[model samples]
Target: MNDSHSAELLRYAAFTADPAGGNPAGVVLDATGLDAADQLAVAADLGYSETAFLTPAAAGGRAFAVRYFSPRAEVPFCGHATVAAAVALAERIGAGELLFETKAGPVPVLVEAGPDGVLAATLTSVEPHVEPVAAADLTEALAALGWSDGELDPAFPPRVAYAGARHLVLAAATRARLAELSYDFERLAALMTRLDLTTLQLVYRESEHVFHVRDPFPVGGVVEDPATGAAAAALGAYLREVHGVQEAELTLHQGEDLGRPGVLRVELRAGDPRIRVSGTAVPIGPRRG
Candidate 1:
């Protein structure tokens, strides 16, 4: 609306309506003149897990070119930031369809008001695929995480999955094992950097359709991400590959252990390579003060 408002970075907690919950993200609705260094500086100053910088696409209205940056580095894709940006746009221009030209690929987002009147955004990820993890690498990952090989669930196995961004998918045998997340930060960060991973998707299946998940995001300069949309999309594709599921709706509960509870809804449609991750976001208090 105003030049002053568009110039300031907007802060929102994605995947939940509560400002204190979910993964906080910085949304620069109009980063038209900001350079790479400027974007990085803004993200680092905000100190969130990640931030979204958007410029109106040359193609037309309702389309934008978006880039995601973590506190330390720029990422190819970021789910929570996308959620935050889409909702932010919807709030101003009415909820419906939006397109983002991302480094990973072109992503489509749908924003609509939920039953409770809060806006929710659904993002369809890029084509996703899964690859087997090498035995030595798996052992090294477990060591960095302070977890033993036996703690892993045999059913889920180990894999490097990619949706919008790459993530290492590791399923713990028990919920307790997943909760006690004390990892070697530097070691894990090195491993993630070498693998070009955005985060480690640590998961435990609560039921056939419900799961509890956490993300170790050392690369982002954050201990953990309360809700990880990219990881969720990767996990959804991983499940489809491992279990041969055609279509399903699964609920991922995250951030509860950290007292910032968040819910991410993952959907897989038969014959569709892209996974859809949906959640709500709420604006936080005055930012960059």
Candidate 2:
């Protein structure tokens, strides 16, 4: 790794304005000097759920070719890290629209200063879809999670949802079931690997518009992600497909159970299949990885 390039790493907490209340991600605004291996090494060393690497886009102005890395592998897209990188860039370049060319697809993000003077970013996900999970695979997931069929909410059925990345969506029958999350990590990781999944989006509906969520990300080498933007986008797509929620805004409360509370807003618009996720991010002090 180039010492000077490594020195430019910026740390930010995504999904919340408070530095201590969101998911921390490592961001390299200019990763033109780093190779794939170097980026992976940085992500592993930082030990965040994911890190963002940005290089000038071939398309030019306000566009970047972005890549995301978890400790274990590179992901096509990552929501929280994208938000972190965008907000970080906005602070330097001023808030506006930015285009990110990701492996998944081109994701457009908008950053603006809110009335309170905090910068927040909204990212429009690539076309999303939900598919049924194989019965055998669902059984294996439930076994690995130590959850029984009866504990699952019948209304929300098990499905694999994708926005920027794939996540298995499982709804708990009760909030308590969602809160107590002790699972067999190795077993779950093996299952996730076979399914090509990034995380298990465990959720409980609090109301028609409010929900609480948690993500077990053994595949990323994290027991639990404090806040997951990719999963939030996937969940929004899942709800729209399963429940016909054509046009409405949804509120998601995450990281609270882990003591790093953060909020994610999911917007579904009429006639648009894409999902939008919005959140605020704050800079956390510099760190080496």
Candidate 3:
């Protein structure tokens, strides 16, 4: 990569104010000159689960065309990266509203300082939908993850959910079941690839409005995503649809299993099909691979 292109890369940890926590994402504030391959190469080099590349929109005031690239491929949308990019921009341009035109759709983001003086970004996802996972597909997924029907929560039936991207939502019957995450990586990757899934949203409900979650992101070439915004949004939709939770704010605790703990706040509003995910992101210094 060219030195100038490399110079444009900014690193941040999303979903947490602490640099050591959250999911780290690379953000290219100006990627007007970078092509798809260049963006992918940068993401792969950084070894982050995903990166955000932005180009000024044609009608440019506080608007940009954003694309997300994983280490191995381009994803339709990414929550943590979006939050990172938005916070990065807010730090420079001042907090406010920004619009991102993404592959999934137009995503509206709001950035503002929280009561604690930390900047937080909230992205409103495109209309989300939840669908059933075929019995055979669910069976394959269970086999790949080394989970059985008995291990799954009977209340939260297995389903494929979509906010900006698709994820298979599987709720564990117990917190212990969610903690031990040794799985067949290649086998899970194959199943996810066939199912066009981005990650497996493994979760255990700690309370009515609290959950502990983990995302296995083999499709993105990452063993796990420390904090997953997209899946959290999908989970909101799933809760609304299946659990009849019309309106409520839910807190998701993720990345704890990997020791990079972060928080994701999911808001579901009555009469609105879109999900809103909010989190704080902080810039991190350069790291060598």
Candidate 4:
């Protein structure tokens, strides 16, 4: 809450209209002058799972160069942060389309007005790719997570999926299994780091297109992330590409286990390879010292 960022920094809870719900994000609408360490300092001070910094893209015209940082490190992409930033921009500049040039690629985000002055954004991810997980690594992941192969859902299997960032998708056999989370933090973080993973997308299918998901984000220096849009995007691609669902709309319920409930809507088009993840955001006022 320094005076320098008094106007530059904005806090918001993304994926929910209520400020008390969703994942909190620190937003620097214009961080054109901040260096890597400066941005990291801002993010670490806020202590949100991730914070987004925006600077005008060199190409310009409603396009911005966006960077995302967790408390511990910089990431190639971050879904909830993107949604948070887009909504912040929309509120300031009025609802419309925006282009974000991320480290992963250029992502297009569409912002729209919602009921009773609420605003939401749907961001189309960079073309995604799904890859098979190494059996040994998967075994290590399960061991580190204190989960067993018998507890896994064979339907979904396991895969390393990427929409904007990478996530290891692991489906639990039941909702109960997904809810009971306890793991060796350092072990999992080491495994995730070696595999270049953003999170371990632990999930349980509630229905055909509805899922209950949780993300262990130790690599980001957090025990768990309440709402993870990047993992949601990765899951959408996993279902379509691996589960063989041609086109679908999926709903991911997250953060409820943490008492900060949030919802993320993920969509996939038949011909379009890009995954669209949508969610609402509400401002959380400014940070306090």
Error of 2 at 46 (Å): 0.4
Better of 1 and 4 by lDDT: 1
lDDT tens per residue, model 4, 129-198? 9999999999999999999999999989899999989999999999999989999999999999999999
Instruction: Give the 10-residue window scoring lowest on summed lDDT in candidate 3.
Output: 1-10
Count of clashes, each model: 0, 0, 0, 0
Off by over 4 Å in 2: 1-7, 287-289
> Candidate 4 — which pairs collide?
none
Answer with 1 or 2, whichever has the higher lDDT: 2
**TM-score of model number 1:** 0.97
Q: Please write out the lDDT profile of model 1 over residues 27-109, one tens digit for every residue.
A: 99889878877888788888999999999998888999999999899999999999999999999999999999999999999
On TM-score, the stronger of 1 and 2 is 2
RMSD of 2: 1.3
lDDT score of residue 209 within candidate 3: 99
Least accurate 10 contiguous residues by lDDT in model 2: 1-10
lDDT of 1: 0.93
State the C-alpha lDDT per candidate. Answer: 0.93, 0.94, 0.94, 0.91
Q: What's the CA RMSD for each of the models?
A: 2.5, 1.3, 1.6, 1.9
Worst 10 residues of 4 by lDDT: 1-10
Of the two candidates 3 and 4, the one with more favorable TM-score, higher being better, is 3
Error of 1 at 288 (Å): 4.0
